[model samples]
Target: MADKEPEALKIRREIGLVGGVALVSGTMIGSGIFMSPQFVMAYVGSPGASLVIWALSGVVAMFAALSYTELGTVIPESGGDFIYILRIYGPCPAFFAAVTFILVVKPFSIAAMAISIAEYAMAPFYPGCQPPELAVKCTAAVMIVVVATVNILNVRLAVRVQVIFLVAKVIALTVIVIGGMVEISQSSAIIVENLNVENSFKGTHYSVSALGMGFFQGLWSYAGWYNLNHVTEELKRPEVNLPRALLIAIFLVTGLYLLVNVSYLTVMTPKELMSSNAVAVTWGNKVFGSWGWIMSVAAALSAFGSLNGTFFSGGRVCFVAAREGHMPDILSMAHVHRLTPSPALIFTTAVSLVVLIPGDFQSIVNFFSFTAWFFYAITLSGLLYLKIKKPELPRPYSVPIILPILVLIVAVFLVLAPIIDDPQIEYLYVTLFILSGAVVYVPFIHYKLCPGLLTKLTTFLQLFLEVAPAEKNL
Candidate 1:
């Protein structure tokens, strides 16, 4: 018999530690940080409480990062949480998660980022240019097309673009942080009265319940740390590098987040932060005076960097799911010359542009915040189930039992806090979208669209071991 050739894997493991960290950091530190403070201060009246909320979010994010590290190291594959869920739970739930990503979460997120990018970019040139809404929509559409072109032309080139943007953003933010700190030290800009314990917890106009709602809104800024895992298969030495990269990236971003917020708090009072829509730009004007336009340019840079990196990573989740036969086959198609998932990238960008058309930025963000956290809860539950059911699996990296338990509790709290504070009919709509995937899966699987039983079985076993409790002797 003639020798058979091994099946080709779509992923090429070219991403290294720096690239991996940039992927995570770039996605996590998006326009959320720039815009979230206003919403947060509106809820929690005190600068002190606002800082605490950001810090608490960081702690919770770190725990989730640890849990994911354990999972990524064991499976060491692409597809991220979708792969983990499909292996541990079954095809139906995995299908739903993947559907949610393609249909709602990824598209809205990318669109929102693009819109913010355009808003900041144009703010300087036009000065008071309140372009017609249609013009803004057109600009957003063009940006998406451009981003898609870059990725479709070459995957490595796309990654390089992401790295360069991220480096520039980080450097720019670092300078802002240093400049803000200098202002704090040199000027009597201290508004210590705003940090009073009683005042800190008070809401600007909303009730305590309303403050909780705002905290949920602020929490959205910190939501993208786990995005890097989606591209796990493309990462080199995923077993060791994936976990380390996540830890380092989350820690670095957390510090950056805290410093950025502190810089804002130092230069601008709580009341000022709560009132201004463009808090970062406002602070920049205060700190830099005539040179404040520089800050607006920096904000634009950060927004573009975030949009580019987030779409690049998020698009892979759809591409991989499609290749595995869980999503539409079109998403799996790669450019023959560029060696990238062109169709998927273009599809994601298209959906994002549609979202940008009718939706307000904050509304899109809130909707995504609600839906994305629901998925995170599901992802964490999958981790817990694997730990209990499969004890023998090797975990090169493991989260402490205490941390997962804590994460689960925090995840639940974060999810419910928003619902309790803001009772919305759309929340149920989001839930329905999540469940609708079950409808799509039955026909696909019945027709044997997926890999054969043995392949699935092996994948399941690997997943079970990856998330299971770490062996004592390892």
Candidate 2:
């Protein structure tokens, strides 16, 4: 195992229980809520099954969270799944994890969130007028730059902004939910014809394959439930608070999601919900008349909070990977004034900006989901490996062994469902792309065979990118 990280390499312990909750909830409650219902309903073809799929998604995520609670506190590192993989599986598999995660998964997610923010913010300004494509991308790029600047300058201020945006997100959901329930009571209109029957939305036989697809879609909406683990090193009383934050955040997000789905059902029929391009905006316009701009603002806040949290937690993945020698050592350095991993943060932001070039949010999400689930399943299975191999490792928190087993089953299904159903060649390309990381690792990292020319090039880049010496006590 590697030596303990020096205090200079450590992150500041400023995130408390509430901030931890905000990180988890705020990140998960993004554009997914506004956009995912249509896809989920399309896959399930029934209002009742759609809700069930959402609730089951929560249960699966909670199980995974419980398993991660043990790892997060016991390891208490900043890299989240990367740290766990390195500890149990060793540097090679961990190297692949870090590379795919930093290069593809996180950047794709940030771009998607930024685009969602742009769409919502632009929607309000242009009523019946389609904004130019250049304006949308420019707005999204500006949002990314602004959020990155906030994180680079002050980590604590970034988190405080996360909490504020999270509050606004909650208020928006509350308004939608309350408004839907009120409408339901006032006008007793049951929208779905065969609510729980097979193919209620479409008059066909029920298909388990379709339900699996719906599960995948719903799980994406719950994607960030484990985000707090990404910053465990920065949390106060992490051993106690990590699990608490996770449980609190997951339960809260789940409740809001179920209520929000029910609210949508109250006003819109299954066909209507499935046909909606912007579900929340459509719901708001139907319910609140011309005062529907609030929903658009709320969606913007959700995406904004998600983008900020992504930058906040995602930089640590690069930092810890650098500390372990998987990345250039310069990436491990933090700014002296803010105690933030400025180089890593800039790297994430720059990659995100580049990802915006191929700007289809659904396509990015599809590409990311397969690789993401692969790492998650591997990381969760590591718990069982560590338990059997190193039983004496002190774990401040532990879940029942069955929880990880069930989560693993669910995770495996999520990983393979899309490929089995659609047989997309792109999935093969994604797999090859992740495996391709080994090409670089075997030559440079394993054998320590970096040429002198490559070293000089990296050094030149590091000169401007990193602080010479990270602060020991900022």
| Residue 31 local lDDT, model 1 | 78
- Considering only N, C-alpha and C atoms within 3 Å, which residue pairs clash in candidate 1? 46-200, 393-465
lDDT of 1 at 126: 53
The total number of steric clashes, by the backbone 3 Å criterion, in model 2 comes to 0
lDDT of 2 by residue, 64-183 (tens): 999999988778777889989998899999999999899988988888888888888888787645556678788999999999999988879999999999999999999988998788
Local distance difference test values of all predictions, in order? 0.73, 0.83
Tell me the spans in candidate 1 whose CA falls farther than 4 Å from its real position. 1-9, 125-132, 196-212, 444-474
lDDT of 1 at 289: 81
TM-score of each: 0.88, 0.93
